[model samples]
Target: MRILVTNDDGIFAEGIYDLAKALQDIGEVIVAAPNSERSATGHAITIHHPLRVDKVRFFDTTIEAYSISGTPADCVKLAVEALLKDRRPDIVISGINNGPNLGTDVIYSGTVSAAVEAAIMDIDSIAISMGSTNITQYTDAANFVCRIAKEIIHNNDIKDTIININYPTCPKEEVKGVKVTTLGVRKYENTFIERKDPRGNSYYWTSGNVVDMEQNQDSDILALQNGYISITPIHFDLTHFKTFEKIKKLNFQK
Candidate 1:
């Protein structure tokens, strides 16, 4: 299988590097990622500026890697449309991210957005994330993601699906088990902070921490907290099914 690997944390990020290595064992892995961190960039694309892709070499791997001056989604789109035009990838895997992307946080995650973009192209994809900010042992998370990626590649029924996987910040043995979960409720406080520059120009920066909400035990965040890997099936369709029946009763055409 031919797999395309990309991330929001840039091509040099330890997470993506380790992930690419792990995935190399499964198939031909190509890495194309942002030149710098594009965290929380969501599903943005670069249209105003001409997208530039530069080939880069990292460590001993001679993989064809591109450093895009764009968001994660742009990297995926460019990889499919421009870079790998000769042979399309069988799957696209994003992340092994620096931190967890749980609940509503997926909406703001560039890591998840890359995978979503691949899925939009009718290819199977996945977003992998570690549950801790500390970068001590990302290899464990990469190994775990490799196992899931194998499953995704081998499962024909899941060809049209996109999954988000989160690994807990713990040793391999301490991991409870894998749990298929739903997005949890994430609350936040103080989204912005005001600061003054050296020239005394006032500016505001967005900053906030995720607040865990109490929900059913089957939530993605709770599963990560309990030392289990969380896997959530994500879809691009954002239609609210419960509201459809009520809206249909309005009789707008009448």
Candidate 2:
């Protein structure tokens, strides 16, 4: 099996390294990611400027990796379209992201965007994240992906759905189990601090406090809060089928 690994965090991030290293035993792992961090850069592709790629030494050349000047979506697009064009990978795994991408956070997540890109190309993908920012280990997350990837590759039932997973920061032993869940609501108390630069130029720095707004018992957010790994299968179709007729009722002309 061949796998394409990527992340929104720059290639140097510990999460991606641990993930790629762990998956090496499973298959040929290719790492193509942004040279610098591109966190929260959703579904964006760089088209105006010519992309630059550098063949960097990662893991002593045992695995092929490249640092590209683009977002997470760009990395996956370039890898499949150009870098590995001759032999496309069977699956694309977009993270062991530095932080959890749950509920509405996936909308702005570069990590999830990479997986979405793969799904667009009709390839199975998984976006795995760790729920805690204070943790250092990613082995459990990596191992979990390996196990799930085997099921996805051989099982056609899981096709066309992008798997979104979030493992809590607690130790592996503390994890209760996996929960198949729905997208939950996550909000933030957004704040922007106004400050003056050394040259007296005023600018605003972005910051926010995350708020768990999920009240549903079967939501991914609630599952993570209860010490369980949350796995939410998502599809790209944005049609609100439930409200399709509601909007159609406001019919204008034929």
Candidate 3:
């Protein structure tokens, strides 16, 4: 099996390295990611500037890797359309991210966006992230990714779906179980810190306290909090069918 591994944590990040290394046991891993951190860069593709890709020797060359001067979405899009067009990968795995991409925050996650890009191309994908900031637990997450990938390879029913996996902060042994969950409400309070630059220029830094408003237990947020791994099947289609049906009742003339 050929796996295209990627992340928003940059090519040099240890998270990607650990992921690529661990994934090698399952398949041929080719990593294409941003040269610098592109965290929270949604589904943006570079159009104004030429995307520059550089061949790099990552982790002793067992894993073929490239660094792109763009966002996470750009990396996977370019890889599928240009880099690996001759032999498309069996699966696209985006992350082993150092942070959690739970709830509605997936909308802002470059890691998840990478997988979404793959789904747009009709390729099976997985977006894996650690629920904690700790990098030490990436091994457990990567192992879980292999198991999930191997199992999902045969189940094409959810062919266009993106499996979003978030590992809990606790140790692997302590993990309760896996929970199939839905996206929950994760909003942040709009608060910014005004600061002065070295030249005394005013700058505003955006920092908001997270406000989770999920009342249901079937949410990814709640599952993670309950010490279980959260696996959410997500897609790029944002059409609300009920809302569409409601609007159709109005029957406005074109």
- Per-residue lDDT, model 3, residue 2, is 91
Candidate 1 — worst ten consecutive residues by lDDT sum?
A: 207-216
lDDT of 3 by residue, 72-157 (tens): 99999999999999979889999989889988889999999999999999889999999978656577888889999998887868
Query: What lDDT score is found at residue 164 in candidate 3?
Result: 98
Compared with the true structure, all predictions reach lDDT values of 0.90, 0.92, 0.90
Q: Rank the candidates by lDDT, best first.
A: 2, 3, 1
Steric clashes per prediction: 0, 0, 0
Can you give the TM-score per candidate against the true fold? 0.95, 0.96, 0.95
Per-residue error for 97 in candidate 1, Å, reads: 0.2
Question: Which one is best on TM-score?
Answer: 2
lDDT over C-alpha atoms for residue 246 of model 1: 100
Give the better candidate number (1 or 2) by lDDT. 2
**On residues 1-254, what C-alpha lDDT tens digit does candidate 1 reach at each position?**
89999999988998998899888888898999999999999999988988888999965797778899999999999999989999799999999899999998899999999999999999999999998886577888888777888888888888667899998888788889999999998778757788999999999998776665687788998898888999999998999999989988897885
On lDDT, who's better, 2 or 3? 2
List residue ranges in candidate 3 displaced over 4 A. Answer: 197-201, 251-254
